[model samples]
Target: MTHTPVDQADPPTPHRDLHSEQGALRGEHPGRAENPVIKVADLAWLEFEKPDLDRAETFARDFGFAIAARTEEALWLRGTFAGPPCMVIRRGRASRFIGPAFRAAERTDLVRLAAATGHAVRDIDVPGGAKSVSLLDPSGLPVRVVHCGEQLPALPEQEPLLLNFGTDHRRTNTTQRPPREPSRIQRLGHVVLETRSFLRTLDWYLDTLGLIVSDFLFLDGQRRRGPTMAFIRCDQGSLPVDHHTLALHLGPGTGYVHSAYQVTDLDSIAAGGEYLAERGYQRSWGIGRHIQGSQLFDYWRDPDRFMLEHFADGDLFSCDLEPGWAPMSASGLAQWGPPVTRDFLGANPSPAKLREVITALRDDNELDPARLLGLMKAMSS
Candidate 1:
């Protein structure tokens, strides 16, 4: 399908982000897209190297994960849902992100990917037994796709509380305290990353994992430069999946940006945030509805400063759905929230960060000076 830019003659009033109307604009990516040999279904778990496993495990529990396995060297964490471990923390001298693992759509896809890429397929000995093929993504991050894991049984779920509205009353009497407990995350929802080569990295993912674009965002006034970021989802055919299982943004560093997990509801998210706060965990940004996925969210900083999100009620799309295109601006991030934080925007300056921005400005393939300037202007606006 062909895609054209949305006309800017009469823009909508500044009430919310342009995702709803803009999400209707969908089509094929600009260039040739081959069908990948393997289709990854869901984000499995994230790997992290932390100096203190105890501290990391503590934060994970407060953020609503139950301990799946804990050894002297590593820890496996999961939510109430039946799945493999949602997070793994390994003891290391310094804290750093390891990367995320995905569950392959079919078990044979793992073998297919291994045969095609010549990467060795290894048998996993962890909690949910499986076979996996690991490959380095274009962003130079390790990506593992696993298959044939024993599905863990779902634990008890927190039932959604009945809310009373002015006109529509569902509940008869009970007021809600929401348990003052950890919001039981249902599953690992999505992961976001920042990479150097935007198009190259994006194409690599599409060609490797059979992922499709759910939405694309570009710097304002630079449509010709293509998109600077894309919220990508797996092609699950008639089955609806999250708006984005993974998203990539153009940036200097190739590292983990954040990972989101689905909680029960807004009450879970809010009360969970309160629990984290009382425990002295840092709230990054949230308690807002995002423009892209439309998930009600709250973010927090883990013990190692990794970004983790608690989200609920995200948009889902069938594989037949096309992608949305929009401008990437700070204001375009959320429908309702406090102003976008500098840290969330990754605007914090370091000598290395300054150099990365400078290097990006110098690399025409990465981003032209005009487009970079336009992005800056958009952020400021």
Candidate 2:
């Protein structure tokens, strides 16, 4: 089941040809090439601490994820459509980095490589007996894998409250004026992570995860846009597999850069951002557009200071073919928006504020300020 990287001398296989037999959904766009491997089935789960559970839950709901279930130790959230839980918050000691859930090819290659690489497969005892295999990628991000067929239904328009007044009813629809309704989570788009070793991590993902770099963000010493990041797509599905499922940023510790959730339209992005600001969630950057994926984006901080994004209309490549790399510059992140800001990348929090942020990530009893204060001082210096 373990797949060694095809020797570079052997040449890249025709990924589109491999997928021709799979019945994967091929977009109508001409630029996209057929991908034979991964299509994002759904976002499985994400782990966070429990103290910030309420804030996290509220943010997710407003951002369009529906609450599936909650316990003293964890929370399970899903999209509006029926599917396995997509987000999971576990009671944990570390607020740094957790892992990502991925749908794999029907073949056993990924699963075998995961075990060979020392990752473990375990059943998440949430509600549904969702099975997964967890292992670290070359860059150290925890990657979980499972075969496909775990598809969730799409959202249906059945809410009477969302109905027009008096068009189909004799009564006035007061629910419209009651409160803002959340847009539904349509699909998982991509995750961005910070790592000091960009190329090394990129190589690891390509060798192990069967991801191909569609495009990259390379830069100079500063944030000039070069291909420092890898936008990897699954190779087993039909053409133009879901644009990049993951992106890697050059930084320390496998911490979050951001996680993108796809929504129905641009109006949802504007409405969602307004809702977050009214609730006092710190707006990081955006309510703008990006140069690469071209999603209308808005970024914000969770109670733990993790970044979550609401995006619409990302540019989809027709194929997984390498489109070449660009130099990394701060200006490259957005084609047109307020210039890239520090807070948007989460580098501006004072050490004390960051400590409070992490403290909020813990359960009711596990917080310790003395230890956190020391860690903060070290990071600040």
The candidate scoring highest on TM-score is: 1
lDDT of each residue in 279-343, candidate 1, tens digit only: 99888898899989899988888877789999999999887766666778888888898888877
What TM value does model 1 have? 0.91
Please, what is the whole-model Cα lDDT of each candidate in the order they appear?
Answer: 0.81, 0.58
Cα error of candidate 2 at position 21, Å = 25
lDDT of 2 by residue, 32-126 (tens): 22332333343455555555566667777867787777887787777655555667787666565477777654436455654667666566565
Q: Looking at model 1, how many pairs of residues clash?
A: 0
TM agreement with the true structure for every prediction:
0.91, 0.70
Please report, as a residue range, the 10-residue window in candidate 2 with the lowest summed lDDT.
Answer: 22-31
Worst 10 residues of 1 by lDDT: 23-32
Residue 378 miss distance in model 1 (angstroms): 2.9
